[model samples]
Target: MVVPAQGLPASVRIHEVGARDGLQNEKAVVPTEIKAEFIHRLAEAGLTTIEATSFVHPKWVPQLADAERLFPLLDDIEGVALPVLVPNERGLDRALALGADRIAVFASATESFAKANLNRTVDESLGMFAPVVARAKEQRVHVRGYLSMCFGDPWEGAVPVHQVVRVAKSLMDLGCDELSLGDTIGVATPAHVRSLLAALNEEGVPTSAIGVHFHDTYGQALANTLAALQHGVTTVDASAGGLGGCPYAKSATGNLATEDLVWMLQGLGIDTGVDLGRLTATSVWLAERLGRPSPSRTVRALSPDSHKE
Candidate 1:
């Protein structure tokens, strides 16, 4: 059933965000032990790049407050990149003190999201990230810049491709090793996705350095992903079991499920180094703990209960 696509890359690197982005928005705090176990399970399931947690102030995101405690338990995990999100210099310092070699900085592509998420304007947020990116690069740590609201903003409505390109170029200028373009509100169609990617390329942002993070709000995540793949984007950001959305953006919904993405990649004969069975099992186990079934269609279809009724 595997059909090789003509333009798609031979392999894609899935930037798993289930451990960090997935759990961060939870109303009920997932215990530190469970979070660590979840990460271990994800790693065991063959995800090489897993976002671990955020180092932002506890007051802002109380769910992931145990980042310091949760990060150490994962030290024993080898061969997987454990990247943490750092909001500012203090967050970066805390991550560095704990021996973190990979970190990500979040940026907003619109003024409204910048004010809501970071409490600063777009340019000011970039200024804040400048030092953090510089210091991380100085220490040879890998840095990823996440640009939110790339396709559309809840408050700003449809974002212009030029506006997104401006912010994206600023993030890359900050010495980031990679940039993840976020469709935060899930309002993007395939044509919009292609337009933005082409604009970024025109502005000198190479496809190799860009990753796509899509939300499934309008059910266009997979379609938009295919558009990116056609444009040669190889890194995709997905959450396990379709777990997370932007806590700040009320209209935002769960991210594109990793299980679903894996299924499509498997069908396309693209290698992602993921074992679908093990990953589904992991999501099922976590779902039981959370008292809800996974939102991922692939997970539900592949789970043991899929045969029931």
Candidate 2:
């Protein structure tokens, strides 16, 4: 039943964000123990790059306030990469103190978002991240730059491709090892996705160094992801069970579901090293803890209760 795709990569590296981005927006803080177990289960389910937590201030995202406590519990997990989000130098310091070698800095593609999210102008925020990226690179830490609102901004409406390219190039110039283009409000269509990738290529940003992080706000996450894959982007940012939405962008919804992405990749005969059944089960287990059904269609379809009625 597998249909091979002509242009897609043979294998995709899924950057699982369930632990950090997924739980950060939750009104109810998931306990440190549960968060640790969630990450452990994700590793067991074959997610090699799991974003463990953020080192942002507790006042900003209280849900992940237990990052200090949660990260230590994941020390015994081997073979999987645990990347953390560092908002500033202090955040980076905290993550480094906990032995985190991989970190991501979130950036905005539009001025509206930059002001709303970081309380600074786009250039100012980049200036803030300059030293952080420089410091991380000094220690040989892998740094990923997350460019949000690449396709469209809630306040700015349609984002110019050139504007995105400028910021993306800036991040790479800051010595980020990789860049994850985020459709923060999920307004990206397939053509928009392709155009942006092509534009980045024109600006000397290779497709191999870019990753795609799409939201399902318009139900275009999968479609957009397909466009990125066809462009030779191998890294994908997905949340297990579709568990995350932007806390800053009110219009943004849950991220592309890992289960949904896995199903599509499996059908396309792409190797992701993920066990779909185990991944679905872990999402189901976490849904129970969150006291709601998983928003992911693939998870809901394969879940045990789906067959009950």
Candidate 3:
């Protein structure tokens, strides 16, 4: 559907990141069966675009070392887009071998973040993705590019808007079907989100091909997401139970909560197709597995015990 003149789309698509982005940084080693169950439950809660896992090296992200084992189990799940993160050509090879049709690659918008996360400079990281993107297209796999630290960086302070637009265009040129702009450090305000989206639009990046991923470091995730929605960002990334932070960026914190985002969107009369009560229950259940109370206010507010069912 076309974005209205106010720039908000009638419906929004949520990219659920709980399985991959959410769990990757968790200290506890979540078992393979549990991870698979998490993904299934997310789909059952009406999330169609759930990011399942990553193929990054075990030494780097031990939490997701079970990607190879996890992918096959999820192969039969229908209607949902189960995209996994592939850090390089090797990861892509593993994913393609398993007949994984959807994959995501991450690139940093700042040099310090690139070095810390991928051990490469920004240009070098893009160079690595060129071949990976090419190979994925050759294999008819869908590719989503993740541009991290788009709003600000820990070491570098505020990131220039132009830097994000440049990297975003490069990823699109390399054949990414969409780009998820990340506020890795979660320092972005609504104004910052608007300016960035405007810059990207000026550079000819269609709003339809862009998504926003925010963290609630300053409790601004939902507000920033609302700003993006007003600017026509249809796809927003959120994690169940508000579970995620960038391990490479210490200042980063929990992602925007899926239940919280759903609550806001549904109240705004935006269709997300998610069952709020079921999604909240899923987060509560997953939080139990993680041995902690969920960080999501919506989940806590809607939970049966907290408020009368």
Candidate 4:
């Protein structure tokens, strides 16, 4: 018997960051089990790539102090590739010790953001990535790169497209599997997204190697994502329940909401392989756990209906 054939799926790779980058700065520390389960639930929902935890120092980000505790519990979850952030040699040693399957390193596009956010110059930060990427490659672990302030910087205002392209190309050359372009301050417009992507494309960075991380401060995240998608950005970084903010940015809100992004994709005839009802429920669940209103409009719209069923 032959199964019915369908048209090409509207493919998109969404990188869920709620557990690490999303909840890094939460005032109340989420339990290690809850964080782990939240991650498990997302993987069960068809997210292939999830940022599970970070190995930064406990004194630096107290909320994620449990990376060691939470990381090991996630063993043997099929179909999901868990990657944790490693800021330096110390962090890398810890993750490698834990047998991390993948790792990510970051650098800022602006000099001020580089120093203030990571306490290093752009050159120094990129320099650090060299060894880390090399070590991860030795261990057969996938390495990813993050270029923060790719769209706009809080301290420096508008970031140059040249800066973004240079950093992205440099990271790709450093042996990164992919690069996530972060709008740390939520100040990027559609025009900004387009211009940056155009510059990268001109520089010969394959569209497949780029990802977008947007914040919703001015409600431009979704719009910017649309612009990015139009320009061939197939990978996106979003947080469940809109769960994160940039600790380095004074007034930025959460990253782009997963439910909202999924909604937009569904409406535009894209296949995300996500259960909207479940995703929305999880968003609301996390928001309620945090004692805050949800940052996702799709979650609000769908949660009650899912419960009615």
Q: In lDDT terms, which candidate is top? A: 1
* lDDT by residue for model 3 (1-309), tens: 223344567889999999999999999899999999889989998999999999999999999999889989997789999898999999999988888899999999999999999999999999999999999998889999999999999999999999899999999999999999999989999999999999988998999999999999999999999999988889999999899998999999999999999888877778889988889888888887887788899888887564333
Model 1 lDDT tens row, 1-309: 898889889999999999989998899999999999999999999999999999999999999999999999998999999999999999999999999999999999999999999999999999999999999999999999999999889888999989999999999988999999999999999999999999989989999999999999999999999999999999999999999998999999999999999999999999999999999999999998988889999998899594244
Which lDDT value does model 2 have at 170?
A: 100
Better of 2 and 3 by TM-score: 2
Please identify which of the two predictions, 1 or 3, would achieve the higher TM-score against the true structure.
Answer: 1
Clashing residue pairs, candidate 4?
Answer: none
Q: What's model 4's overall lDDT?
A: 0.85
Rank by lDDT (best first): 1, 2, 3, 4
In lDDT terms, how accurate is model 2? 0.95
Q: What TM-score do all the candidates reach, one by one?
A: 0.98, 0.98, 0.96, 0.93
Q: Give model 2's TM-score versus the native structure.
A: 0.98
Tens-digit lDDT track of model 2 for 1-309: 799979789999999999888899999988899999999999999999999999999999999888899999999999999999999999999999999999999999999999998999999999999999999999999999999999999998999999999999999999999999999999999999999999999999999999999999989999999989998999999999999999999999999999999999999999999999999999999998998889999998898594243
Score candidate 4 by TM-score against the native: 0.93
Mark the 10 consecutive residues where model 2 has the least summed lDDT.
Answer: 300-309
Considering only N, C-alpha and C atoms within 3 Å, which residue pairs clash in candidate 3?
none
Model 2 C-alpha RMSD to native: 1.1
